[model samples]
Target chain A: MAVREGLLALLHEGPRHGYQLKTEFEAATGGVWPLNVGQVYTTLDRLERDGLVGVSDNEGQKVYSITVDGVSALGAWWEAAPVDEPPPRDELMLKVLMAIERSTERGDAHAMSVITHQRTVLHSMLQSKRRARSVATTSLAARLVTDALVVRAEADLRWLDLCEAQLNGTPTRKARS
Target chain B: MNDPVLELVDVVKTFGKGSTEVRALNGVDLAVSPAEFVAVMGPSGCGKSTLLHLAGGLEDVSSGRVRVAGRDIGDLDLASRAALRRTDVGYVFQRLNLLPSLTALENVALPLKLEGVGRREASARSLDALAAVGVTEQLSRYPDDFSGGQQQRIAIARAIVVERALILADEPSGALDTMTGDSVIELLSSLPGRFGTAIVLVTHEPRFASWADRVVFMRDGVVVDQTASTVPVSAAGAAT
Candidate 1:
């Protein structure tokens, strides 16, 4: 969804070749997600077919521009809110639930160990993020990326703590030294 | 490993008599080395605070030994234990840390003052501590005039003023908002590297506790488990 809208957003600025959009996307995302030039052209073809973009020959090369419809689409994307309410089904939730279920079935304490292990990982991640925060000195995008990782890591640890509290009925496994 | 600045050997703390007794800490053993960061976490009534108090020699241990900077606090006299607490220990509570009557400089300098250091030398040392925590302005202002986050920073400056071997902080960021709380934890995580002092932070929030090098979890007056940050779990098994 973002890739499609991101292309339209880039065109909304002005006309650009496929390579320009590729580089711009990389720069904006801090090079976190790499985009293929072929895929960009394929998506551009679809946009042209849908009347969302116009192609032109500029300096013996093809350039893409956002049409009126594309502008409206980009505007709509801005107004549309993302869904985050119901706590989307994610891998961590699945792992924890299964670990607890397995522990109960086998009369063993597996979940707390899982929780502790996950917490330790999150803590180490946080430490690295702390270092990154200090080093990500100049660019706002890079700084925000690090901040996002930090908060996400923090949230995951809190969820693990919640799981530990809910499973307190089970005896805590004596942690390994 | 460097020698532990604080060590609790088979520490047990209890309150009241037989029928009305409540065992706060049950045979907990922990050692925090110099320049290490340790956090204690648990449910309510889990003796996290008691563990912290015993570490700082704020409360007497019912049995076993408590050592600070390699000296046995239990073996020392009352006056001597108090002196140890003053000279070798620093505390940061959730709130009410600073004296309302004193300026920020005086509050940080109070620890050195209590050691009978001269006014000139104490003020100079206090300024350095304040600078270390990134506080240079408003030294003349009282604690009441500053925001909660600023007050917490100043409180931290006081804790490190004398370069104490151990700092016991009990939910230092409990009262601040998310961003402010995060900055406080960030400042604390920098302590071990900046000052070479050991830190024992007692907090229920894993977000704040995640900054520590090791985290200890307690239950029913017992140290149930602990996790160290050295070996992070595979990033492939991430979170929600």
Candidate 2:
């Protein structure tokens, strides 16, 4: 979520204090763009540093009003990039890989245990993803991200099954390593 | 009791072209009464979720009739069907899909507001829904702040808050620990009578499936068994 430019645009609506800005942003965007208090301050400081917003101190409280440049930046960001698509990183995969190392030193039992747990978790996740897909009433980018997650989760599950088979000393791939 | 809230007759869903195709659902038949709770169980790829989707109007069936509140879903135009879904169906998924930014109350209220209810009224009804699910204290908190059980409660609140006739939940309690899942199941099983909403839940856990007033088992896209047990069926009965 782009916080700075979006926050700046809200300031352009009127000169407002940080807390009020956060509250108004939440209400204005229908609770979609939630602003944490700390993040609101940090973004405001950066905006002032960049000369995109002018800060006025009144009664020991700082009020921020959007500068012309801030308005332009907000417009630019809105036009250029309304959504962010980050790459997928599987934290579970990392944990599973670590377990595989432990199993190599320990015993097949540990590896089998890991695989079993992952199977249960993946099955749950897949069902959840299917439900989410069914009721998705949101942006295209969000739906795409969900689709990617589901496919990746399913692939990890298939790979886990293969690992489980190998760990069990099944007669596949000629022989176990 | 005479007119079912939802009815699926010999539903079939297929994916891909002839030779390389897969039959996701095969000749499934089911019905849910007003305010009834039904759980669907099947192995992965057995079409339990497919049945839920057909009932919710998320996907169309290859063949068979899907009716919600006496209107055939297949007979409606795309826009009309979408409207029906927005107003008549509320869905809960295994993963809590609550928008992170929205407060619990707002997340619950989004559906009402989307359908053109005023903000104050939407918020008020959302608060009532949150209260019903026992999440009233967490009203202003975002989804990330709460535990999994609480989030699922909020999701449930969202599903039935609009007084939708049907709520389709796909593995609503699948993500949590056993204790939390049980709490969620209790919360879900209670809503039908409280809100007068029919529900179809897809789940793999027998304990979770047991929460339903009825259970329908599917295999290879067909409903193999259907039975109704009064509320609070024995654990052994659930396992079977």
Candidate 3:
């Protein structure tokens, strides 16, 4: 989806061939997402089929440019909010819940230990991401990527803290190791 | 590498005796080299605050050495420790960072004045400290007139005013909102480079700790781990 919108964003500037689109997209993203030339052409085909792009001949090679409809579509995409995939990739939370259930039966403190260990790991990850951001001064895209990771890790750490707080109710908390 | 401005070697601190004894810190070792920023992070009752207290000489260590500017604090008497704290160490707390009645310049100059410097010279040095923290406007304005973030900056200015070898701040960002707290932490992260003073910050928030050159984690009165950030700082050394 982003590739389609990204191609439109590039074509919004002017006409470009498939390889040009691929290189420009890679450079624009600071090479964080290297797009194959084939992928670029495939996305362009879908965009052209959807009337978001118009292809023409520029000295034998095909050139793709944004159409009147493409500009409007890109504008809407820019303004629209990003969506998170619901109920997806929540493996950590599931593991914690299952661990709590078993730890309750076994009378062990393993669940809290899991939370503590994850907190340290996430904090360490954040330190690395923050370090990356500090040194990525030359590339805005690289810096932004680290910024995203830092915040996401911070959010996970907050959730772990919340789990710790909700624990310690005697029945569930002091399940001795 | 520069000599550590502050070093805690196998330090221990306990409150009360025998039956009711509370071991606040049990065998923690840390070193803060010149112009380095170290953050101590842990949950409550983890001895983070106790460690800062010992580092600033506000409290004595029980069984180990705390050396500030190369002198072991355990060997110093009360008067000598007071003088050392006055001259070599600075402290910043979460609240009451500045006196309400004193103007910004006076707040910054308070430490120098207590050190027996002349009023004119103290004021001159205080002005530079204020400027270093980017507090140039309204030197005559009291702390209440400034915003919370500005107030924190002034408090930091006071801490750094006297070229103290080290500054120990305990939860300095604990009271502010997220954005304001972030700005304050940013200011602290810049201090080592601009002032040549080592900083040991005690905070539970990982966000703030991420800015430090190194972070020491405490658990149940023990130093569980110390990790160094990849951010470049002077005298980068291995964490123990």
In model 1, which regions exceed 4 Å deviation? A83-89, A169-177, B229-240
| Docking model 3 quality class | acceptable
Model 3 misplaced regions, further than 4 Å = A9-31, A59-61, A67-118, A139-142, A163-177, B1-3, B14-22, B177-179, B229-239
Q: What lDDT tens digits, residue by residue, belong to model 2 across residues A61-158?
A: 99899998988887888689457653343666676778877877655556656666666556556556545654678665556666666666757766
Q: After superposition, how far is residue B216 of candidate 1 from its true place, in Å?
A: 2.9
The best candidate by TM-score is 1
lDDT of candidate 1 over B137-168, digit per residue (tens): 98999999998999999999999998789899
The C-alpha lDDT values of all candidates are 0.83, 0.77, 0.83
Instruction: Give the CA lDDT, 0 to 100, for residue A167 in model 3.
Output: 69
- Please report the candidate that would top DockQ against the real structure: 3
Q: Compute DockQ for each candidate against the true complex.
A: 0.35, 0.01, 0.38
Give RMSD (Å) of candidate 2 vs. truth: 17.7
lDDT of 1 at A163: 86
